[model samples]
Target: MEKPLMIALDFPDLDQVRQFLAQFEQTDQLTVKIGMELFYHYGPAVVTTIKQADCDIFLDLKLFDIPHTVEKAMEQLGALGVDYVTVHTLGGFQMLQAAKKGLSDGAKRAGLPKPHLLGVTELTSISEQVLKEQQNCRLDMNNQVVSLAKLAKDSGCDGVITSALELSDLVKSVGTDFEYVVPGIRMHQDAAGDQNRVATPKDARKDGASAIVVGRPITQSNDPEHTYQRYLKSWTLK
Candidate 1:
């Protein structure tokens, strides 16, 4: 079975992605995330190139925009044949609905496979202090996260992007229909760096996250494969 983990190939260049992939075998069953840094650099063609090598792709553009614009963009992204895509839930109800509709429509028009559309709540980099002080949002961190997850689900998203710290409350509040794809995951031994709401792979799985996104913990390691395996093994344990 494929591991319930998607490695973020966050390289700014396609060459780096290629070099990393070359280290693994064809039948390795890895799902790769092409986030903004890589996507902005390589574009949709990079998606096609990676899939041709037999890896499922998660296109994490984290798009946030007006309803009409975001909807239209999702139409194009759906046509690219990615397995999953994301938008910011903070964009409001209209944008989320438009995105859902647009992706569905795109699937019908082009006979393309519809990707699982996820809503990004707060970024893992954001802190409760920032929400209260900088953004003037009064909700506590956990409450704010649950509120957004609920909105994202009500808005027709199939899943959410959040840290594992908030996963339990989200699952309790919203039920299991919405998949939780937790990012900001730091391996137990890894540096926390800029991420604030981080979790180890085991914790994320225990909290019922459907998938976890790991970037620097693996990519920046001296042994990328070994680091990836550490995440894989952690998730695989019963």
Candidate 2:
């Protein structure tokens, strides 16, 4: 599988997304993530529009629900022909298995390939202190992430969306074939924003991340196309 550098289209609306993507040449293809903020506002039509532009989509809603509900939702999303979709590992083993089945069934029905089902371990904005104090999680942050990765893999997920800070440890625990789709990647000079645990693109690649999802550093840059190319180069050559 290609280790794609995914640009998170975190814009509030489709217009902003269009304006930002307009910087790239029409023939240039990109792997993009459409998260809740934009998707919720425009629904699946946003995904269709991006698909029409020949971009691979990673729908990052991080679905967490009852097993049947999540399964049904995955079935619907699979028909969208997205390259990847996220499900919260906290949904447990049964839900994970059901989601996998739903995606496969949906893809078969739609005559498209199954999308990669990525489990979300934990949000990058969460810190050790927050985990222990607010979430009442007793294990350390790394342990908690590894534990989730194990569950995700054992339940049949193809990969996990984790912070780059934990990618190396997760790979050690789950083995390399279990894809590490890392987010919270910041450039050396960029602000971390709400994400507490962040890594640079080169560091993420060095840590053995299968792919990295970048948002603000590229999307909010003064020159989005230039910044995106810089990130892509770092992932490819570093």
Candidate 3:
């Protein structure tokens, strides 16, 4: 329960979000991720609703652009008081630094602590084939993920969103001082769906992931709260 667990709330609207969250008790201290869809549909207002629910927010837009533009955008996003925000690791050092500075500056203006800046490495949907043929990246998937993670660590990112398969290598390569928020998590009974490199919560924990994101396994379950609690139990098991 103490370990960070982020549930991906990929719903497109606030009403559905409320309905889903209402299933949980009021005392629950949930940490949820708001990806591009909800944010695009409802804008900053979505963050307000999440905050009102007494939940920690992971604003996972995966911002990627020139340094100046990203910096400015992060400034606005940071003011929403989210616990974490993401940038594309491929954006390079200057952009990452700009994101951190912009986030800290905006947070200060709003009298809130700066949200952690997470760099998104290779997405879980990407495989070796996709990396080599589609993106045309010379480095293999694991090497590229580790490389981007190291760059992110040096460039002021507090953590990275990498798959659990690369989590151990990330810890070994980048050191434990950086956070590793792994996604593409699926239990044994869950379908892989579009994910290419998914792992169980136990695998992620064993590999030294600082946090983990679970979407459909819980979100799409017949009983979301029960599924979430069950996963949380497994996540903490010795």
State each model's C-alpha RMSD to the native.
1.4, 1.1, 1.0
User: How many residue pairs in model 1 have overlapping backbones?
Assistant: 0
- Ten residues in a row with the worst lDDT in model 3? 22-31
Against the unseen true structure, what C-alpha lDDT does each candidate score?
0.87, 0.91, 0.91
Candidate with best TM-score: 3
After superposition, the stretches of candidate 2 with alpha carbons farther than 4 Å from their true spots are 26-28
Candidates 1 and 2 compared by lDDT, better number: 2
**lDDT tens string, model 1, 1-238?**
4335888887878888888888776524888898888778768889988988788889999889999999899888988888899999999999999999988887667788788999998889889889899979989888998999899999999999998999999989999777999998887779988999999889998888999999888888888888888888898787
Better by TM-score, candidate 2 or 1: 2
Q: Between candidates 1 and 3, which one is better according to TM-score?
A: 3
Please, what is the TM-score per model? Answer: 0.96, 0.97, 0.98
Q: How many collisions per candidate?
A: 0, 0, 0
Off by over 4 Å in 1: 1-3
Q: How would you encode candidate 3's per-residue C-alpha lDDT over 146-173 as one tens digit per residue?
A: 9999999999999999999998888898
